[model samples]
Target: MALFGKALLIWLMILLLAIANGILRESVLLIVVVKTAAFIVSGLLLCLCIFIMTYLALPWFGRLPASHYWRIGALWLVLTLAFEFVLGAVIQGHSWAQLSEPYTFKDGNLWTLVLCVTFTSPYLAARLRFKQGSKFL
Candidate 1:
């Protein structure tokens, strides 16, 4: 329960960051070489934020059974993806195909990075050693 609460907070933070980035994306797009590059850059930026959050934030949740990390990571991924889809469909008025476009990497979309980060963050956080060479959340 504690693990889920902490992971949910982290996921929410990441989601807010992504939404803020999307809002600013239009201005950033002006200087980008292409749309695909912009997408890639945004995805990378979000991943970096995830890494930082995992390092600094996870500790607050306290220690957990090692196996919980895997469940938390999976939960984060599932919830985040579901949020994205619903936001795209209901709020943004994007069609199913349009929302699905991000996962279509062959078209040069970079959203795959988002998935990779989500899937790995909790487990990575669990494995990371923090101050005093001790394991953290």
Candidate 2:
């Protein structure tokens, strides 16, 4: 039960943090800050969200050979690109297909690889953290 609570809390916090990107937008609160600050915050949030989700899902990946972790990461990246960029706007009734037509890459827009790295790094970190017998600080 404690593990469940820990996982749930982490999930909620990660979600709320990620959602802040859209909710906060680029308000005067952030606009006044240095340019790099925004990107740093953005990167931190992505890393946190990826960490929490992948950590929670790790046990579900049981008995899968260690060699396949990258597959999980790749699938996650594909899903993210599909949901967030491709189908998301359509679901929201926006014309995403038309907008993406201007771009040459059918695989995904520019941030796909960036988001993939964000997702994978945390899984690796959690693995390292476990191996090192460290707890979250």
TM-score for each model: 0.83, 0.52
**TM value for model 1:** 0.83
lDDT per residue as tens, model 2, 1-137: 44445444544555566567635536642676664565455555566566766665555444334445555555555555665565456666668666554244343222433475645753584575568664441
- Per-residue CA lDDT of model 1 for 35-136, tens digit only, reads 777777667777877777766776776776767767877887899888988888889999988988788884455678778887887667667644346655
lDDT of the candidates, in the order given: 0.74, 0.53
Clash count for each candidate, listed in order shown: 0, 0
Q: Candidate 2 deviates by what RMSD?
A: 6.6
TM-score of 2: 0.52
Return the clash pairs for model 2, or none.
Answer: none
